[model samples]
Target: MTEDVPGVMMGFMENWQGLSGTWRVTLVVFVLVLMTAVTAFIVSRLVLWLERRFANTNNLWDDAFLHAVRKPAMGMVWLLGVYWAADAAYRYSEAEIFQANEHLLRLGFIWLLVWTLIGMIKQGEQLLSTPGKVQRPMDYTTVSAVSKLLRAVVIITAVLIFMQSLGYSISGVLAFGGVGGIAIGFAAKDLLANFFGGFIIHLDRPFKVGDWIRSPDRNIEGTVEHIGWRLTTIRTFDKRPLYVPNAAFTTIAVENPSRMSNRRISETIGIRYSDARQMAAVVAEIRTMLESHEAIDTSQTLIVNFLAFNASSLDIMIYAFTKTTEWVKFHEIKQDVLLRISQIVDSHGAEFAFPTSTLHVPDGIELSGLDQQGQTS
Candidate 1:
């Protein structure tokens, strides 16, 4: 038995030796790799099914986010599997190829992890915004702009961190960036200005979406639809889309008349100067017309003897505010008020003033001379 024990031990050592090399480790790694791939495929299928079923039966937005995240999630799962396999095959370090492959897998896993986290952040953004939080007047544009900016920041930060993790000297990179940043800044000055302008718009609540804005330099009357990085898109009342630079909005005077709770209507009507003695009567008539108008805000009504004479007419100005914020309603009210004033003047025996030239003969030439005048008398 003692002699046979040595042979038996030798046989066991031979078997152990066969399984101890890089080949055996490689085979094991391969099996693990295959298992991970299959697991990922199954998980991916499950995720897709869950996404579709949940989307159709419940939250559609989360489904969209899941769809966007699907590939990234699968990549992460495969990466995790490879990482586990690499750890299991640690005894194969003698094979430089496998060692390098392990390092590559580790790096790949990190990359996939970053991508997955980014997808999660994007999905979270969508979920957070689905709760009717974006129902405010300008909230949709603001939230969209902010979401894009956040993603940009996230990408930049992730890239820099990954570079550092890859053993690149962060200080050297930062120093190089400092020099290059100036040139890049110069090239992207306008773009950066608009980016900051978006923040300014958020901080300083100006005209909201759907508010008509009139700039001083140009007739930019439109509804703000999107606030982007470099341009703010406005849909004009005529349905033309105007892409205005963000810088212009900061510098230009935007008259947001639509933001006002009510509209103002100012007008002037001229009466014949010959009937100037009925000035008080005319004023009373104008006041009555303004007071009775449903659209005009009576609190702001101002009836005045506006002017003495202009060419051939006496002009009276009637100023008032429309109780509506709509331009069409204000126009309609102004038209009705003007019509009422015209009818009032006609009723009071006062005519509308028009440009007239008076022609008179000389005093001595009147009535065919003084003799004819006395005889006719």
Candidate 2:
């Protein structure tokens, strides 16, 4: 066994020295690949460790960063490993493909960086928008707006750098863009209008994601789901998705019922004319009930008064606001209030009115001579 070891070492060295340059290059490439595999494994393990470590912290930045870096870092490592391997091979042949290795590497680097940033932006947006995920979560609309804007900027910058890396002069491109922009603007005026309209919406913030909005000018009534640069997506009450161009919002009047501090309950109730004496008492009691009701907003206007006299009944109007603005809850409160009003009217011995007619017969006219027959039989 000891003699076999010496022979094996001598033969291995002889074979190694006898190999041609191409074979040596091939071996080098294989070694490089093996090293790349090992390095990738290490990176993956490290990322997992850091992810676990950072997961315990309340800060969102580290988590986002780690998530964004994983795939891009892996891609970059593989890219560099292959580039180096190819460069080593090209050193012998001076291949055309390998000549542009630096440019390719630079472009790949830019792409990976953009990818990382976009991933980070998405993660951060999610982290910030979710309720209770952070100490002070932001509204989803605002977070989405900021994230989309950042992603756009990152993509644009990456494209510019990519162009420059390809030897395209930035100044010349800018000059041409300036001239082409006017023509593009004229051609796509409506699209541009929508884009700017969305921008205005972001700035003014009349409504946001999850807001219940309606437009009197157009048939647009829904809850906003997503506010994009071109279109804002809304989920209708019937569960249909409605996509509206942002430009439409600029020309229309929108009502955001979600933002209302309180829901108003305005109704006119009618009762028989016989109940006229109880009107004042009913009104006073209803007003007093509203003033003390737990669900009513007494800070707002509350009026229970006789509005007008109808043809068939005496009309009373109830004008009050509820403390809650939730649609279902408001209706429940309204139901309770209406039921209480009915109880109040009943307590005062008043009944609701309906259409009725009256007949009159005077003295004793002996059928007025026309009831039996027209021929006077």
lDDT of 2 by residue, 222-328 (tens): 99998999999999999999999999989999999999999999999999999899999999998999999999998899988898989998999999999999999
Q: Which segments of model 1 are wrong by more than 4 Å? A: 1-45, 48-68, 77-138, 218-221, 236-238, 304-306, 363-377
Model 2 ranges off by over 4 Å = 1-15, 361-377
Residue 288 in candidate 1, Cα distance off native in Å: 2.7
Candidate 1 local accuracy as lDDT?
Answer: 0.72
Model 2 — which ten-residue stretch has the worst lDDT? 1-10
lDDT of each: 0.72, 0.87
> Mind giving the per-residue lDDT tens digits that candidate 1 earns over 160-207?
777776788889999999999999999999988887887777668686
**Each model's total of backbone clashes:** 0, 0
